[model samples]
Target: MTSLPEDSPPLIRDNDRDTAVGRLQEAYAEGHISHEELDERLHQVLTAKTRGGLQSALASLPEEDAGTTSTIAVAGGRIKRRGAWRVPRILKVESAYGTVRLDLSRAVIEHPVVDIELQLGTGGAKITVPRDAIVEFEDLQTGWKDTRYKTRRRPRSGGPRIRISGTMGFGRLKIRHARR
Candidate 1:
């Protein structure tokens, strides 16, 4: 049998297509692209067969804000965020004697990578990440309780990468992916 041509383009996967679509949606939501442009780009992303084609579809979109950071600190109370919130590129959360809950399932995440630094003392934390998110907590240090997380062996391709690091003292940290 004859060998295949070397010039053939690399095929694109479903997850890659989903990622492009997400970027397009974000650009549209941020007013970087008009409705018509979003439609056109979305169509291109849906029909693209190769990585180059996908890149072309995402061309000219504004880059995400990579320098933005937000901090949430509580000395003796609960800190919670959920429901359509805007997620910054870097987030620092500190709790001295209360619980911290962060629900990112419905949040608008503009960046592809997000960093979360947690410092907890005598309080627990429950973090619900987006369904497609890839979580990394290798740099976290625990005191009395080990973090509760069901690690994914094969992370999805199109979701944001959440990097979590910091210290937890005498409190448990529970992390789960969103169901919906």
Candidate 2:
């Protein structure tokens, strides 16, 4: 079989495509991409078919100086990630006595799927994704805890996916769809 373009964007759904376009616009506003480059990249983002494709469109632009890992640890407070934020490849969520929420409705996912490691104690966590997003819950070690997956039905293709693996203690874990 032939190989796909190295710079090709990952196949994303319409929602992800729209979010990627928004990020391209932000890069333009931040002077990371020129007018022509923005236009070109926007086109690519709109038509990207793989995660690499979208990433290649912005490969030439400056990126956020954030840390490599995405982590949220809560002992007694709430942690929420919303709006057009970058979705890390690997995420770690820990809660001891508070709640953690990861909203992927408007997130800019860098990969076709993300691995989330969760550890909870006397607290809860919730993840909200787009209606069409796919979610796979892995082996979870829970102690008197409740876990619920309320996300919409998984699509055959094009949508982002999340794989969750971890443990919980007297806490609740839920995966739900965004209220569009």
Candidate 3:
């Protein structure tokens, strides 16, 4: 039921959303839309599959004032935070090796999940998860590099569930230092 304003900036299209994003960039450069507005509208532009679909797309983006905060910060990376709901701590990451430092961690836990996304633009990335939790996972992309995390020995008790997903565009995903 949500609709774009009659005067809303003509609207953006899926194929043209990129161009619209560029215009938004110009708008920001000219001090038209605030950073917050740009971030929000950008979300709409990306989520929208088509020009007409943009109205709803833009509307669905999480507002700064909204309870939840979701953003895609990098050139080819998007970080979406959904529901601080529950669970110890969950970090879903999508990036290349250049952001590997952001991926490494030294922690032990009963239940922990580290979701990693690798792109061809990436290299040497690994995730460290506690060995206490049960391990249950599936390969998103079939390949040797994607199994880097599977190299670790799973704990005997129900086996900690560790899920590692990879794509041809990415390098390798290794799960290391999983404390038992």
Candidate 4:
């Protein structure tokens, strides 16, 4: 096999491409970039073959903030958050024996990525996300019941990404996208 040129930039992986695309989307959503600029940058990221090319596509975007995080812990009562609440960048929820309800259909979310870490014991959670949001729960572990979420086959573009993780024992997690 012929060796690649020493000056050739390293090839990028799919995850790298995805990360770049996600950053572009976040910049667009936060009004840091115009629609036309987002389109151009996205195109560049998608077609980039090397790490250098990908980096060029994201060179102008600002760095993501570490952001504020809040945690709610309950031993035996329900925890509910609804009706135009402000959502932080990272939210940690721990419930021992009660249901947790979070309604984000009409809430205020300024960040592009929201992480919800749940540690539940003998309880469950119901989460309602915005219609355009994207949800990922690949890191969640359940002991008795599985999570209940009907994922859209094609999620809409330019929405916040909600990542759910942690362990649940003897309970279920029901997640739904809002209708309005």
The model with the greatest lDDT is 4
TM-score of model 1 vs. true structure: 0.64
Clashes of each: 0, 13, 15, 0
lDDT of 1 by residue, 18-66 (tens): 6688788888988999999999989988989899999999888877445
Q: Which window of ten consecutive residues has the lowest lDDT sum in model 2? A: 60-69
lDDT of 4 by residue, 43-149 (tens): 99999888989999999789967689999998999999999999999999998899999999999998777899999998889999998999989999999998899
Off by over 4 Å in 2: 1-67, 151-156
Better of 1 and 4 by lDDT: 4
Residues 1-180 of candidate 2: C-alpha lDDT, one tens digit per residue: 999989765567665676577567778878877899888888888777777787788686666434356788867788789999998978898878788888998998866557788888877888888766778775677788667875455454567767788988887888887767
Worst 10 residues of 3 by lDDT: 64-73
C-alpha lDDT of all candidate models, in order: 0.88, 0.77, 0.46, 0.90
By lDDT, the candidates rank as: 4, 1, 2, 3
TM-score of each: 0.64, 0.58, 0.37, 0.74
lDDT of 1: 0.88
**Candidate 3 lDDT over residue span 1-180, tens digit each:** 998878665544333664455556656766767899888777877777556765443443333221222222344443222222222323334443243433223333223233434343554444554444433346456444545544446455433345544453445545554443
Q: Which scores greater on TM-score, model 1 or model 2?
A: 1
Error of 2 at 41 (Å): 28
Cα lDDT, model 3, residue 119: 41
User: Top model by TM-score, which number?
Assistant: 4
Task: List ranges where model 3 is wrong by over 4 Å.
Answer: 1-73, 76-90, 101-120, 142-146, 150-154, 158-160, 166-170
